[model samples]
Target: MSGSAQVRAWQPGLDGVVEVLHAYFPSHAYPSHTHDAWTILLVDEGVVRYDLDHREHGLTRAQVSLLPPNVPHDGRSVRPEGFRKRVLYLEPDRLGADLIGAAVDQPELLDPVLRRRIEQLHGVLADGREPLEAESRLTLIEQRLRQHLRRQVVRPAAHRDAGVAGRLREVLDAHLPGGITLDEASKLVHADPAYLVRAFSREYGIPPHRYLTGRRVDLARRQLLAGRPAAEVATLAGFYDQSHLTRHFRRMLGVTPSRFARS
Candidate 1:
């Protein structure tokens, strides 16, 4: 995956119990991993093959999936179109931590009520606003996510091994403008290079190298969108050459960096 990182995260309210995220995986997969918070997803387009526990569950357009906290899982694309989904996060303490551990056997499916709430959530989140309208929508979504958690006994544990994964997050955030080798990042997380590879694949469903490359591409896109020269943005985004950047850009984003920049 290349072109630019388009993943975004935000906390929209004063409650602090909820967070929202939007991600576009053009040709990437998240390896097996768990989140510290609950993940409630609304599949907007394409398909996502979610590997939860030991079984693979395929979610297509309009399907809703709920992932309880600390549940080992990974994601894969079920088709060539790739997948795009919106995810909501709610904390365990707010959800009553013991609730999820009890329902580990049977998780709830997204019903119509939850589905409608998800649509509203997506509208507010995607708009990227801070007005009362956005805040009100955010609150509605937060309440709904928590309500689902209580009903399903799901707690927020969306990321895999929060303590260990936090280290990786730190490195990723630090090197977002460039790119980091999985080997080098492994040192920071205190995991062996090979193990890091396996773990990232298992937890996130994508290889670490691909993830880094995608992130670099994402950063380059942002710079280019701001009117930076392609050659200059390429180096700043950790590409060795513009051709290297261009090849990946077309492959992942389905357009040249210049074209995307114009958008």
Candidate 2:
């Protein structure tokens, strides 16, 4: 391991995300290992030389690489300085098994759009506040990845589902503090989960989860101003707990619930 190596890993609240890792290794070599989830990697510094299916590949700054689940792979820095990388370990089903062969054959992609979107998705995932946003981004990224694997042209979907979007919004509003899962919303709205997310985001300025969080924050403010304790206000606002409420509240309002209440 490199003496200067630093790593941060966490499982985000997003259901589609298995885990996220950001690491820097000055000098380390990875032994062969296989993951149950897809490894989506972005190298930000230096270079990574990794072997997938016994073939060596180089991941550089310009590419987003996807290592298929259950593929044995190993990595080490191309230089003495090692490499810095951010990774998203996604659910195995995020991409179908049929594409595994394609991914294994060409794990590194030169698509700038995919790289940018993956970076943005990482940003959304890191916040841990916008599950809907993260899911939406993830869905599109997965779609693009599939297209790449299948050698199809990467293009935007021309269809819109305003009817499904409107119904999903109603479900979200009705569920409120209880909240609903994307799967649940999809089943209830009778639409594909990916379509539900894309449509909701387009119909409303914000994604459903963020919209719900905003509504919860609004309710929280009202309760705080009414002199309720932060803890109680959290429950009343539909947040999981005080800390949960604080995360979104502070992000939206720029102050903690306690501070807001005191003021």
Segments of candidate 1 deviating more than 4 angstroms: 1-55, 60-62, 65-109, 117-130, 150-169, 181-192, 195-205, 221-232, 253-255, 259-263
lDDT of 2: 0.79
- The TM-score obtained by model 2 is 0.57
Q: Over 4 Å off in model 2, which ranges? A: 1-3, 152-263
> What lDDT tens digits, residue by residue, belong to model 2 across residues 142-215?
99998999983333433667687769867977887778899998898888998888887765435677767765
Local accuracy by lDDT, each model:
0.65, 0.79
Considering summed lDDT, which 10 consecutive residues are worst modelled in model 1? 1-10
> Per-residue lDDT for 107-178 in model 1, tens only?
445467768867776676667574566657656765665565556544465556545554665677687666
Tell me each candidate's TM-score: 0.53, 0.57
- Best TM-score goes to which candidate? 2
Best candidate, lDDT-wise?
A: 2
